[model samples]
Target: MAARLPALRHRDFRALWIGSACSSISLWTLLLGNAWIVYKLSDSSLWVGVSTFASMSPYLVAPLGGMVADRAERRILVRVTRLATFGVTITLTLLALANVIEVWMVVSLAFVQGIIRSVEIPSDQALLANVVPISDLGNAVALTSTTQHGSRAAGPLLAGPLLATIGVEGAYGISALFALLAFASVRRVSVSSRGGVTRLRDVGENMREGMVYIGRTPEVAAIFILVFAHCSLTMSFDAMLPGFAETRLHSPSGGFTIMTFGVGVGALVGTFVLAMTTGARRGPLLLGTALASGISPMLMAGSHHVPHAAVGAILMGSSQAMFMALSAVLLQEVVPDHIRGRVMSLYLMSAGGVMAFMNLGFGAMADRTGAPILFFLPGAAFVVITLASIATGPYLRRIYRTGTAVAVAPAA
Candidate 1:
């Protein structure tokens, strides 16, 4: 096997990757801490969903952010976003320290963070292509997934103790420090701009072009459908996990941490395995992983035991990580550099925007039908979606015939 992680050979990519991992860790810490606090305060599953919705709803503006990303200097955009996150976290920390932090405060700040992330997500993904050669893009994306999942493991594990000892204020303080470090790290990455002084008029034109690009390209269009389905059907379940951990598993915050820890471990393993593959068929891998993701959640729905639920979490995490990482690799490889940011922003919108709306529904559904039904129904629907995509989606068929499609002509 040629080295498992060729992307790390590039210094700028290494710096960007490490910084992203730290930032991801901090974000997850904030999420878990906030979720746990909400659950403790309200004892309501709906609020947990609402908290997630607040954080992700800003993705409605992702297209605007994407236009900015395509036109602006990505490194500078990322730095500004991180700085915004730092301010939000620090303010939240101070609020918690004052012993007056309320659910509304958390939701409002999360909405602000979501707005910053609207810029950060696409800009960050678009910038990754600048740091590494095209040949190493897949490896870079996989490694990024590994970092994301690894941080998932570290964050919840850290959150429990931080909550028990230093309290929510301490957790937010630590999160702020991590955000500051992420901001500092982005300062070191240099990107050469190709879009050149984009006029305000260009945003509308660019947005239209991006929409046309997807509409005209079958393969690209299929990728977005799959991403949207996964996010809406499977990822929405994440917001309901705290209730599952407490009521179904009958475990405290510690058990919730363990289940998420299992998920992180599996995701790390899946990303590492994908990183090492030289001839993996992207279509079959994506379809199979999607099926696995669906099946795993169904397993959780049936499990009366904590270990089984943990195992289910791990499987779902693994499949989800692989699907997302591969989709990113493929999208970056195929998209024209000039419009990469806009396209990536659309992808982000598919994930964040769709999941944002679905989360509220999932929360409401869980309250009525119970969390297990939410898991079983969506899990079943995902498997059907994957199978249907395979039968109908031309992009998947192309992947099956060829090992991969690392390069497809950019859209008209």
Candidate 2:
């Protein structure tokens, strides 16, 4: 943990991490609060899916968001987005407090938040890379992932009880406070331009270049595809949890939040494990970890009791965090800095957009056939996908090595 904080030795990285942690905590709180509010408002599984969709749809423009991040002043972009989030959160809180909150209003506000998030994602990612040295980049990225998972675990654990005591309006108000803190933290960081001049035409060209590069690189493309498949098939477990808690677990609405927290706990543990073993050779290990992550969701879905489900959530969270952190390190190491933003944007798009659609689909599946089936089917699919990835590990590693050698070879 002390070693992980070395990035913090740099004043700017420390400030960025503080702001990011606060923002992430608030974001998780808002997610749980909003989901619960929507569930109560419409009392339909479909509405939950629609609301989630509205919140995540901005990932559709992630490449464009990357363009903006590469072209714009990332510090200003982050500050502006944080302020926007604060304003929207305040509005939502007021509406909820006045007893005039409607599902559409929540959805609309969520859409706005998602738009801000789209821009924020790429900018934040790029800025983090800039703040750290190239050699320490992997550790920095791992630490960032760890911090995010830590907050994900802690946020809902705090929010669950708070939601019970103060209701959704109060939750929103708390979230707004955290957002403001994040804004202050961002203001403390000094921004430096890394990439050269940004041209309008370069945005499209950069995106195209990234796509082509991934296409040519089999291993990178495979990573993106695997993430997409996992997101599509297994990552929607949260959306199905409400029905699971209500019917299978025989728990109250709060169980959904608790189960989500269980996953967070698992992720926190996983992140710590990665941070501790920062120098470990992660290539083959990451492949297995990613597969395990995909399979863990099925175990949770098949769980007969809340405890069993919690166990599954823990495994899923931990494995998934390790998988993502390592994968990001791999991509960052392999790709050139010039196009890293665009490639990472595609990575986000795969994880975000594909995962959002899966959540909606799984929710509907749970509504129709039953939530248990949601677990059983996807879990089986995840296992199959994991096994397949492991089988191809040697081939992928060879491709990566060959690509690296070719890139490093001197000019003739």
Candidate 3:
């Protein structure tokens, strides 16, 4: 805790972390509320899948988003995005309260919100570099990851009760309030003048450069591959789980939401553990944790009851958080500042894109072979890849060290 506490000592980083956590809570709350509304309205899993695709497919614009992030003031971007998110959530809540919210309208609004998130996500990532000193980047990244997981865990748990007590509209209204607070926090952070000219062409060219950079570097390439493999197999489970809990497990609609909360709790714990460790080497531990995270979902697939599934979800959440946080720290330490946004965007694009395709495919597959197979197959695949990654950990570490040395040599 002491090691982790140092990162919070910095005023800007502290504000960023607090604001980001609040926003994360709002985001998850909105997700739960939106899913509940869609499920209740349409009574179709396919519609849920479509809505999710609408919400997430905006990762395709990530390269452009990254370019904008590098050019714009990140603090301002954060503030604007939070305000927009607040507005969107409030509008949706009103619609729900008025009993006039249509499924298609919800889906359309989700897509619009996704567009804002595409810009916001990259800017948020790039902003940490600006707000924190370079020496504290790793710590800041860790703290940020921990805060995200903490909010994720808290949001779903809070959403369940709020939705149960006050209805989905109230849950959404609460999320809007959280978003407003997040906006206020972002407004307080002063943006550093790391300004660069906004070049639209640079979006494409910079994306190409980022791709080339990753292609030329074995470590970066490996990270991208690992992310694709893990996220594609494991992350899609969230989209499919609602249907699984509803039909296969014969649990109430809220059961799936509770499962999400379990994962969030696991993730929060994992992030805290990662943050507390000092001088942590980022290779073998990360790979091992990723493998563990990937394999945990199989347990859920085989579970005969909701409690069993909840345990599996918790493990999956924790491991996923550890994998993501450690990988982020590693990337931040290695990539050059000039192209960090583009490079990280490529990673995000790969992860998000793969997860999206996986969600569609898994949803369709669950419809066919049933939910159990959907969980078993992907979970097993993750375990296999985890082992493979561990075997190659030393080689990957060497590659990362070499590439980082070369990237920093010119600056030196």
> Best TM-score goes to which candidate?
1
Q: Report residue 94 deviation for candidate 3 (angstroms).
A: 0.8
lDDT of 3 by residue, 294-352 (tens): 67877777877788888988988898888888778777777766667777777778877
Question: What is each predicted model's overall lDDT from 0 to 1?
Answer: 0.81, 0.75, 0.76
**Across residues 166-248, which tens digit of lDDT does each residue of candidate 1 receive?**
77887788788888988888787875653322775766677887888887777788888888999888877757787888888
Q: What residue pairs are clashing in model 3?
A: none
In order of listing, the candidates' clash counts read 0, 0, 0
Q: What is the lDDT of residue 112 in candidate 1?
A: 93
Runs of candidate 2 with Cα error greater than 4 angstroms are: 194-197, 201-203, 393-412
Tell me the TM-score of each prediction against the true structure: 0.95, 0.92, 0.93
Error of 2 at 36 (Å): 0.5
Q: Mark the regions of model 1 whose C-alpha exceeds 4 Å error after superposition.
A: 194-197, 406-412
lDDT at 355, model 2: 70
Write model 2 residue lDDT over 1-412, tens digit each, in one string.
5565466668888888889888887787787778888877887676777778877878878888777777778888889989888998889899988999999998898889888888887778878888878777776777778877767676677778777787888778878988899999999999574443268475657677778878777667777777787777766665677777777787746667778888788888887677655443565557667678767876776777778877887888888878777777667666666666677778888888877787787777778887877776776787787676556665445533342212221111
Off by over 4 Å in 3: 193-198, 390-412
Question: What RMSD does each model have against the real structure?
Answer: 1.8, 2.9, 2.6
Worst 10 residues of 3 by lDDT: 403-412
